[model samples]
Target: MSEKKYSEKHEWVELNGDIATVGITKHATEQLGDIVFTEVPEKGKSFEAGGEAAVVESVKAASDVYSPIAGEVTESNDAIVGDPSLVNQDPEGNGWFFKIKVSDVNQISNLMNKSDYDKFVTESA
Candidate 1:
């Protein structure tokens, strides 16, 4: 089974077994405007929770996409790199940045669920 979680910085992580797919939230894309570029981490690259894992740039600004949990990157979505606008078009689906072999599933518990993330976005705005 897959469970999705969100970070305070607006990254989303969906865990299915040891692999966790990570992406910026839709709210993040909305804030970023039209995304023009993306740089995904190379396969085998390791990151600690909260470590900067990728780069996403929009017409308005460039942002770092952080890892929500410690892991080694197993795959990256080249589709988003080839067509950056895919992030704005589908931030949670095809826009996913990478998949990692999660080092500690416990870290996922620290992130928010959908309802909590929605509330956080609302209260922060």
Candidate 2:
């Protein structure tokens, strides 16, 4: 599989075939250090673009997790619910939050690839 793509809002999506794994980016986790709790969506629930899909709570703040694409949640990382710091530890790997069966593949085209995401992050800094 290829490295994940990212959104301007600090979310990442990794596509393996039609299923997409979604999570907050490293920058996001760093901004919300020491995550303590997570409110994840129930598997099988569908959410539209920009819809609230989950919540990540850190000692510093609680942030809403938005859906980068419209899709049905297929699975969630229960490990993060028990140990939210997993996100703070590895935002791109063991820290992933959920998986979704994507509905609109074309939405993938609108997201930033690694290079573009890097540029966006740098400019926003």
Best by TM-score: 1
Find the 10 residues in a row with the least total lDDT in model 2. Answer: 1-10
Please count the clashing residue pairs in each candidate, in the order shown.
Answer: 0, 0
lDDT of 2 at 114: 86
Q: What lDDT does each candidate get?
A: 0.96, 0.89
> Model 1, range 1-125, lDDT digits (tens) per residue?
56689999999999999899999999999989999999999999999999999999999888999999999999999999999999999999999999999998878999999999999999999
- What tens digits encode model 2's per-residue C-alpha lDDT throughout 54-104? 999999788899989889999999999988888999998999888999998
Flag regions of model 2 displaced more than 4 Å: none
- By TM-score, how accurate is candidate 2? 0.95
What is the alpha-carbon lDDT for the whole of candidate 2? 0.89
TM-score attained by model 1: 0.98
Cα deviation of 26, candidate 2, in Å? 0.7
In candidate 2 the C-alpha lDDT for residue 54 amounts to 94
Give candidate 2's total backbone clashes.
0
Q: Once all C-alphas are superposed, what RMSD does model 1 give against the true structure?
A: 0.6
